[model samples]
Target: MDFKNSTENNEKVDANYNVVPLREAMCKTERRLRRKIDIFVVPTVMLMYLMCFIDRANIGNARLAGFEKDLKLKGYDYNTVLSIFYVGYILFEIPATMCCKIMGPGWFLPLATVGFGACSIATAFVKTRAQVCAVRFLLGIFEAGLMPGCAYYLSRWYRRAEYSFRLGIFFSTVPLSGAFGGLIASGILKLPHLGSLKGWQMIFAIEGIITVAIGLLAFVTMTDRPETARWLTEEQKELAINRVKSERLAQAVLLDRIDATKLKRGFTNPITLATSFIFFLGNVTVLGISFFLPTIIRTIYPSRTTIDQQLLTVPPYIVGALLLLLISGLSWRFDHRQAFIILTGPTVFAGYAIFLATINANIRYAAVFLSASTAFALGVMSNAQVAANVTSDSARNIALGTNAIFGYCGALLATWTYLPWDSPKYMLGNGINLACAATWTIVGIGAAAWMVYDNKKRDERQAAGMEEIVGLSQLEIQDLEFRHPAWRWKL
Candidate 1:
């Protein structure tokens, strides 16, 4: 008897014993393996992102720790330093995301993490404003790939429907980092024997060390693809690959190929561009609140000491994190993206407006909570909508990268937009935030209307003897005016 035939017989016996078909058996094995892979994916990605947020926002904590006073920073000096990080961040984000496509996340993401961690640690030693700026710029360069790379990476492991919630779970770390950073800073600032190191310096050192450690763990554990994932069975691997392929085909995207022309089409597409602009405005609100909320809290209660102010920072973030998780769960449960965004935008705007107009400390504190919670939901909607609308992997990658770049650009704007000149009340920043929120509301409504109208047209086309055109893939249907003839602008 032939050895190959004998092995086949054994496989058959195994399947019989398992009471499942060969495909089912393979799928079962794969699921078991994939479970282990998820153990790494969920935790490692969250940890990596947590570090990313902490490193970026540690400067906020630094401001409260006399960092400005020690360095004699004056006249938009700190703002310049903060804004420069985004300059480097924007410069490298697209290129870094493209590199991840070429090099794979297992290598690219961890390497970026290590590079940023090194720069973050080095920040502890920076003596002057210029030196701080240089280190932050370098840190941003290394961190550029994180958001897009992680989004792209998750796209590989999960289906499109599952993407938003996971994205929310991962991105929620941004708000959570605010809370964690505050708590950690509160504790670390009180430590002795650090030898002339300020609390901000300790914050950087400690967070950077944790990042480097996690980067090492990611290197050891990250899987590049289902085929390479050791934990998945051969059957499960095929299903994982085919499911994404089918989704891509439905969206008119070529899974294994990058069409530069189509990628450019995504850039010029009205929906894509509008969404990017929306993201830009959204980040203005996000970063403005993240960086300055503490200062605002301190301003409301000026008599409180530094530690008390630091502790005060935790509540808003805690509120934001909880609200994000709640909204993400609802969004995932209902598969309704646009609806949540439209509803939450007004809340965010109202929150800022209330803060701006109110003088009562209680009402002001309530405004902080409201702003954080509503903003968290709005961010989840923004990220999910962008990812869902773009079809091709390459196009989606580019679109997301561009959105992030512009988002950082908005953040850079916020660095100065929320200035010390308007502090204590931050009249200008509050006004800016209100405008941003209103813009988000309008854009979100337009996009949602378009999605609804376009979906209806898709149904109409299906009814009109266009069976072959029933489910055009995202890339295929993107240029509907030219390709589908019957396609109209949805909104």
Candidate 2:
């Protein structure tokens, strides 16, 4: 341990701040800072996410506008383009997160956004299916960093109890993008053939341009952390820093501490891996629905034109977005995460059940509303849990990034699950989603139970003065604060 550095860090706090009760000061500063943080930081990042999701998934809308036919995509090439976004997406999530953490989101996020925006624009110009696939791959690499980066960024600003609502607010933007993208594409697709560009080309070019503009704004507006926030006073900064250091899930005990060893600890930890698989199961429903719902909706309304179908797609996602916000509010108010996640599984199960059992398109359409509402809400609760349970930034990058990879794996499954052969009546696809929901239900139950037991055990250990990691533990594991007996999972 660096005794000198530790003392200096501690004294810096004491020397600058007045002697006041921490709880009183925190309570006072928290209210004010919360408002400021919510206003200044939350909305900015939420906009970035909105732009991110819309651009990433607008290809669904683009497909309707003739992305597939224009390039003469043969065989499974369309699916290849759809699914290939994650090839780069899954590969770079962790590394990009690490970069975002190291470089600060202010610089890194905007840069990544510009990269994806450029890719999105280039996707409009592709001459062949190979070019489409290549640009989509590049788009994935840039967009991969944003989701996990958003999670880690918020972990720095909010405490455990406040996390879900903020996550819900930010993540709600994902489904909202569906509604927004559909509405935008409905109009954008009608642009008179510009030079040689088609409707789908216009969708990519217009949305991509908007995304790039926002990325430029994000560079100027975003703050690195509360302590480093130029908008705050020294006292406010101390209050924020102290509150985090005193927190159970503080990313780093000190602002400057990274502990590269936290990386190895996260990889080796059983609980971290378990949580990720839980994320994998939870993600299957949402990602599956997001990527495929437009196509699924097209089949549901066979009578409608592609533009009409695009217009029709907006309402379900709007409902899902609104419902996600309500659910996230409840989860945050109750301060229990798993119960909400467990409840969502059944909702998804019901939706999938209806699809598999019946031929009624109306009934199946209703099921889409039910499933998307629940699936999108799962991310609101699940993402907060990922942030709350992990110990440090390094560990968070590894664990959350690993979880994202699992998510894309589920997304990969989603692309396959609803094949054209099974379209309109996609019994096999619905059945697989049913199994996914059921597995997530089981995992949610087990994880909730384990958290209860683990929290109890930690309580017992702390009472018995046995908080420390036992003998011969590595330097990395020793630095992991989540291993302490005082740590409690937000069950």
Candidate 3:
């Protein structure tokens, strides 16, 4: 709506179009486009991430269903299976992101889904611990593309202010998948062995088949970007494209050009490092609980059957999913990402602190709820916060890839978290988690302060006319992608 009156004073306009008409059109077009995108992109990606997460996660379920016992896994063998996947996961993330961008998300995402889904299917038939670990590693290679690629893809559709809400919707699937996967596993595990397949085998096969079906459908339903969204009118498309481009311009970022130096700068940025560390710690909490929640529940209710364990897992995850959405929405409505994020650290810390203090199964069970509801939700906010700070697509991708690598490293660490020696009462692991929670809280405070300081400095410099840049080419913007004095980070 901000516009200048032409010399004639009869019309308010800009070079692109008449401001009044454009705003009016955009008001309707953007809302509808968002609705369509919400319906199309969010569910599809959420389902994709759900399947992707469950494929990795179902191993824990499978373990409860006798995956480890049947294979005769000894000592750390099962943990190695969990940890090795992240090795491949860490290696393939950057390449998969590059592939997703090059091939277009619609095509690339589905292909990766199918690849990993097939690996999940292969996991059902593993004859040895070694075979299972190999399948998990290959599964990692395919699964690596999903989260980071989805993050980048979703960002294409909305501005930073609007982004966390959408990302929250997409990421809410993490806990939802756990809940759904629990319900699914509870049902699937009740089945009698069919043609030499155990209940756990059926779980992998059926879940993987569902993922493949979803992936095949993603090509039909998902669009690469708004500019190419066929469901929109050409006018809507133009307006949508310009909207995002304008946001980039306001942040002093280069639009539509890949700056090679962006990769270096994004990875090396102090802010990016701080945020990535936050992301890494967040993932540590996420994977540690996700992979070990059922085990934790089993400790609390030692007499329960596998079915009871599966069913019990549902409520905590369901709560986590709901809280994830609520927090994300509140963060967006208030425009305060950091505040919501810092609170999660205490929730995680309290979960562990309570566990470290008591041997009571009921209190420990309550601790599980605290851990489940906040850790992954915190990770969601962390990713959104990082995205808000990162302005360029390439830079965002690099920062994301770096985060993914660290995230998997957290996954790797998580695999070793609840050791065989620490069973039932994982006091040592809980202590480490408490320490991590404190680190996350402290660093988040520092990061928010840094943003406040930098924003204030930028305002001071701008008032003095000490900083200015406009309409720079990709070449001109080189070496100054996100650090441009005009770029102000979101806190």
lDDT of each model, Cα atoms only? 0.76, 0.77, 0.81
Off by over 4 Å in 1: 1-37, 250-255, 461-491
Q: Each prediction's Cα RMSD? A: 6.0, 4.6, 3.4
Which sections of candidate 2 miss by over 4 Å? 1-28, 194-196, 249-252, 463-478
Candidate 3 residue runs with Cα over 4 Å from true position? 1-26, 250-257, 463-474
Report the C-alpha displacement of residue 144, candidate 1, in angstroms: 1.0
Tens digit per residue, CA lDDT, model 3, 266-362: 7887777887788788787788877888888888898999899888988888888898988999887887798887888888888889999898988
Residue pairs with clashing backbones, model 1: 30-233, 33-231, 250-473, 251-473, 251-474, 252-473, 252-474
For model 2, residues 112-222, the per-residue Cα lDDT tens digits are 888888888888899898888888889989998788888778877877778789999998998899999999999987778657777899888888999899898888888
How does candidate 3 score on lDDT? 0.81
lDDT of 1 by residue, 126-169 (tens): 89988998999999899998987887788777655566778788
Clashes (candidate 1): 7
Candidate 3: residue pairs that collide: none
What TM-score quantifies how close candidate 2 is to the native fold? 0.90
